[model samples]
Target: MLIDHFPVLGLRVRTPRLELRYPAPDELAALADLAVEGIHDPDTMPFGNPWTELPPDQLARRVVQRHWKTLSELRPDSWALNLAVFLDGVPVGVQEVEADDFAIQRQVHSESWLGLRHQGQGIGTEMRAAMLHLAFAGLGADEAVSVGYVHNHASLAVSRKLGYAENGIGRGVSRGKLALEQRFRLSREAWQEHRSVEATIEGLEPCLSLLGAGEE
Candidate 1:
């Protein structure tokens, strides 16, 4: 049987050539290896945090730790769902859907990283669209938000493709360094109006309450 905590095991979102899902153990191991191989190079920081500056093994450990922590501390109010992105049956990177005070916030946020080798194939946009489908259609979210470092044009472009409008810019300290972040938001109505990908879900029934919603 699929794991109970993450019924999203069987739940998948597919594009013409990519598949997204919560990784099972074997798949998660493969994903860890992908991270080990390198998602970002040491000198370049696609993410605002300097976390990528860590050695490859450390970076790989961090990826495993995130999955472990999320499952161990599963909660309704705040949670992180990490889906391994696979292209042609091989792990390429991770996509995350997260929320804080989700039971009350009625909102969610998206984040993701594609292995440097897989960066420009339009996979980012489709993966994000799939997450929005789950947030707005599956979880009944009112809005979904995302933030990109001011200089991360590629991420900003993905948000724009999904019809996310600029909310504002804010300053924050990341990895002990100051950074500027550009916030973006998309309402349920806006998502429906602008979405273009075809996404479907399965195995969400048992986990629906975890999302703070009743079956629709």
Candidate 2:
């Protein structure tokens, strides 16, 4: 099985309403379809790269290619785990956690988006909480950080609900205009206190070193 050669592919995180895992090729295709369906308002670009603005064909290709690129380039020192978010066996979106020099800094950053039909339904918070569990409880991370444009209330609210503190503020360009960004940080201590959603990790032990979780 592929998991024998790349154990990270076996990793899974589950919450009451969601399951997050590395997407198989077909699942990745489903995700591409979901992305084409729509992730956000056409007028607003939540991601710094403005990937959502691409045409349907390009967007689908980008989704598949980006996942392939990340998997090909993963290493202990730097990696991004873009877990496909599944709800009731259907692909809904993505919840990603990534780090640079995680063995030393022990910190991870996360970002996510949901299908337009899935937004405002609280699945975002639950899925993010699952990733937090995988990072802190499963991977021994010291802190987790996230950033959102100041106007992105859904993202900001999820961080606040999870007990993240305002870490800093900055300015960046969004869709060609200057935008304010809000950074939030959640330490392990805070995570322990604020954790509410029940979550579990499976197949993480074998993938630890691949994620730089065993370097130190």
Candidate 3:
């Protein structure tokens, strides 16, 4: 019944070990609490923006606010889809894919973070690969780009494993200090080279037009 009114909720992306889709209200709260629990080492700043520096309550509030903002501001040409990632039916992290003028550029950008407990496992790679499947295979994207802090080796490794080439370095301010960000580029050809994870996407056809993928 709800899918009839909001078709985006109908979309689903599934990997061998995970399921990713728009988070319901309860799931959004779960994702927020997971963020508060931990995402990375407190001594190091892995993200360029430093959103995690806030106190737990503020950080949790930011996470919740961001999801709602993205949903409210969505446009066909420019939008962000923040999906709650569930591994074996347990909430583990958030996977975000977004674009600016997607119809014209056919480009997408991605960012994600798994809870501290879920890290050091292959879950991060699988979650990213699953989103890449939605971007490249399901939506027909030409390129997908990601940026990670230079010292964020784990993120870099995941991008490399997914066949992304090193684009260059991007400097930015993080926690009032200059941060080295590594840019990664994944062309369709490069993406085709890596397919270790098997993924399936469902309920995409009805929403294709809204995503500028043309009518079925």
Candidate 4:
């Protein structure tokens, strides 16, 4: 089976209201359509790269193309699990957890987005909590980090709700202007204290080696 050969394809992190998993081709198509529909407001750029500013067609194409690149380029030392975000079995967005030298550093970084239509229902916090569970509980991570532009209130709110402490400040250019970023960090201890959502991980053991997390 494909899952046996590519165990990452079988990874899943599920919460009561959300599921995070590798996107099947059909699900990936749905995500692309969702991206074309929209994510953030036009006047503000949440990401440093300003990917959401691309034309509709280009944005859709980039969604699919980026997923392909992440899949093909995965390695034990550096990898990204760009799981599609599904709510009630419907594709809504993406929840990504990535790491560099994970086994040595035991840390992961996460980012996510929900369709504009899907925002404001707490799905963002729930989906992220699910990933946090996968990182700290299933994968034995030490710390998890996230960064949000100071103006991106929704992302910052989610981080605050999840018990992330301010790590530092970072400055960058976004949309050709200065962007102030609030870097946040959540240690495993903090996660355990702040975690309110229940989540479970399935099919992670087989992909441990690929994530540089296998028993040594």
Candidate 5:
């Protein structure tokens, strides 16, 4: 019944090893707890924002708060869907896809993070592949883009493996210092060409209207 109203909650994206969905309360807690343990190396700031730099408690609170905040602000023209990432039914991280004026632009930008323990073993790349499928194939998006810190090889590697080519470079301030960023873009054709992970999406039809993607 709840899903009947918020069909986005019913949506699911599955890859070879990960399942991503609008997180239920308990799952969101698990995801938050995962963030408390850690995300990335403290020595280097990989994110453009210093979210992970907060104390563990503050960071965990931010994790849960951010998810709930997004839920309250959904709109057809501008919206973000932050899905909790799970491996073997255990929450491990988060993946977010967002767009402003999506109906007109037909483009989506994405970002994600994994618990420190889950950073390797190809999970990050596979989970991202799932979202790329959801965008280009499931939602008819024309292009997808992401910004990664130049030294964030892990994030950039995931983009590269998923067929994202460098769009350009920009400089930003992160952790009170200058940071170089690489903008990456992937077209539908490119996604199809380099997509290595197989992904399956479920229950997306009912949310198409909400996403303004029904016309596609």
Candidate 6:
């Protein structure tokens, strides 16, 4: 029998209009559909990772595999908290907050994507703020970081709104092409100073220990 993992199964974080959580069995299907439908225009590259270049179907499969692999492996060194971004009960996208050796890093990195239809709604900003709350307030992280292509103004704008300051720039290859990326960081102090969103977390207690926290 599969021992139900409460930490993974019961995680949840919420903002005014959205709830970010680990997808339950029923919700996971919906999340997969959202990925299959495509998060952005096929012609546009929004991520530093070239995995987004796959054909629509392949991209969808990868999304499903990611959810499964993360759960099955349950590794301590690398783990990703994949939250299905819901707006008014509909699956609109995926928000991934991740870390490597989080106990040591004391930092988390974020990545997210909304369907093309959902772009320009300010949902991105609110969603990102929700994750920030989880990292800083919920998990006691020292800082949070995110990156975007230099030309992706919308993403960079969202990061700026969430109090992320430009850290530096780096060149990397994506799909065999050199790309310039702007890295941004938000220290706990900056997050406290600039936090604006009102958030509440539910169903997180069971997972608190997994967050590398010493005590509740």
lDDT (10s digit) by residue, model 3, range 86-145 = 988888999999988888888999989899999988999999999999998998899999
> Any idea what lDDT model 6 has?
0.80
What TM-scores do the predictions have? 0.90, 0.97, 0.95, 0.97, 0.97, 0.91
Instruction: After the best TM-score superposition of candidate 4, give how far the Cα of residue 163 lies from its true spot, in angstroms.
Output: 0.6
Error of 6 at 73 (Å): 3.1
lDDT of 6 by residue, 88-176 (tens): 98878888888887777889999898877777888999889999998888878899999898877889999998889999998976557
* Overall lDDT per candidate, in order of appearance: 0.79, 0.92, 0.88, 0.91, 0.89, 0.80
Question: Candidate 4 lDDT (Cα, whole model)?
Answer: 0.91
lDDT of 4 at 146: 95
Give the poorly placed runs of model 4, Cα more than 4 Å off: none
Instruction: Point out where model 5 deviates above 4 Å.
Output: none
**How far is 214's C-alpha from truth in model 6 (Å)?**
3.4
Error of 3 at 117 (Å): 0.5
Q: Give the Cα error of residue 139 in candidate 5, in Å.
A: 0.4
Q: If ranked by lDDT, best first, what sequence of candidates would result?
A: 2, 4, 5, 3, 6, 1
| 3 or 5, greater by lDDT | 5
TM-score winner, 3 or 6: 3
- The reply for model 3, stretches above 4 Å from the true place, is none
Candidate 6: clashing pairs of residues: none
**lDDT tens digits, residue span 1-216, model 4:** 977777899998999888899888889989999998989998888887778878988999999998988888788999998899998899999998999999899999987889999998989999999999999999899999999999999999999999999999999788899999999999989999999999988999999999998953
- Give the TM-score (vs. native) of candidate 4: 0.97
Cα error of candidate 5 at position 96, Å: 0.5
Full-model lDDT, candidate 3:
0.88
If both were scored by lDDT, which would come out higher, candidate 5 or candidate 6?
5
Best by lDDT: 2
